[model samples]
Target chain A: GAGVSQSPSNKVTEKGKDVELRCDPISGHTALYWYRQSLGQGLEFLIYFQGNSAPDKSGLPSDRFSAERTGGSVSTLTIQRTQQEDSAVYLCASSPNPVYEQYFGPGTRLTVT
Target chain B: AQRVTQPEKLLSVFKGAPVELKCNYSYSGSPELFWYVQYSRQRLQLLLRHISRESIKGFTADLNKGETSFHLKKPFAQEEDSAMYYCALKGFGNEKLTFGTGTRLTIIP
Candidate 1:
């Protein structure tokens, strides 16, 4: 079966620029998650979506970070006015349910220079 | 606040030797504990979960509420086991997971 997939394996941008990262969850998966991996913070949860309910954005580091899942399938994470600190590997994952095991994507490495 | 901690940044053991990767977590309520592994050039994947009480790839972990710990153990190490291991916790009814910094285990042949 196809696993979760992310776009733009690597991205390099200047500070203050905006970037959009896309994620395509596995078919029939109702739960989607966005996480960030960096040298300083390790792995940190960014946001999560479950069905049509409200998304969980508690883990977003700042107001500049936002994400939206459409049609209960594809998700896009947007970071506005990116800072050097925002440089990290953005990973996406999906699960059949909240309690089930999650499958991860190859991740997009974002570099803010 | 929920948190997971992996004390060791890196651990090395010879093949056929016993290995233990320590993990401790702090949460207000009962939490679901999991071990995720990532091999070189591979995406992170679930290695085992405490609730399942089943071993995967010869790895096992036990949840100890009293100590607030869930440590991964293997009786015999293999070179293939060399990879990054992360301990994670999800609070009851919560969708987000708190993850540890991760431990890089290297099995020497």
Candidate 2:
């Protein structure tokens, strides 16, 4: 079966710019999550979506970060006015349900110069 | 707030030697503990979960509520085991996970 997939394996952008990272979850997954990995922060949860319910944005670092999952399948994480601190690997994962194991994608490595 | 801690930032062990990667967590309620591993150039993947009580790739972890810990252990380490290991915790019914900083395990062959 096809696992989770992410686009733009690597991205380099200047500060103050905006970038969008994409994610495609498994066919029947109902839960999608975005996480960030960095040298200093390890892995930090960003947001999560479960079915048609409200998305959990508690872990988002700031207002500049946002994400949307459409049709319960694909998700996109957008960072506005990017900062150097945002340079890290953006990861996406999906699970069949709340209690199932999450499958992760290759991730998009973002660099802010 | 829920939190996971991997005390050691790095661990090194020789082939065939015993290895232990310590992990501790803090949470207000019942927590689901998990070990995630990432090999070089590979995406993070689940290594094992405390609830499963099953070993993966010769690795096993036991949840100790009294100590608030779930340490991963392997009787015999292998070179292939070298990777970054992250300990994570999810509160009951919570979709988000609190992750540790991670431990880079280096298997000396």
Screening candidate 1 with a backbone cut-off below 3 angstroms (N, C-alpha, C), the clashing residue pairs are: none
State the weakest 10-residue window (summed lDDT) of model 2 chain B.
Answer: B90-99
lDDT of 2 by residue, A19-64 (tens): 9999999999999999999976679999999999999999999999
Q: Count the backbone clashes (under 3 Å) in each candidate.
A: 0, 0
- Estimate, for each residue in B29-65, the C-alpha lDDT of model 2 and write its tens digit: 9999999999999999999998899989999999999
| Model 1 agreement with the true structure over B1-109: per-residue lDDT tens digits | 9999999999999999999999999998999999999999999999998889998999999999999999999999999999999999999989887899999999999
- C-alpha TM-scores of all predictions: 0.98, 0.98
Candidate 1: Cα lDDT at A104: 94
Candidate models: Cα lDDT each: 0.95, 0.95
Candidate 1: list runs displaced more than 4 Å: none
- Could you give the C-alpha RMSD of every candidate to the true structure, in order shown? 0.8, 0.7
The prediction achieving the highest DockQ against the true structure is 2
For candidate 2, the per-residue lDDT at B98 reads 82
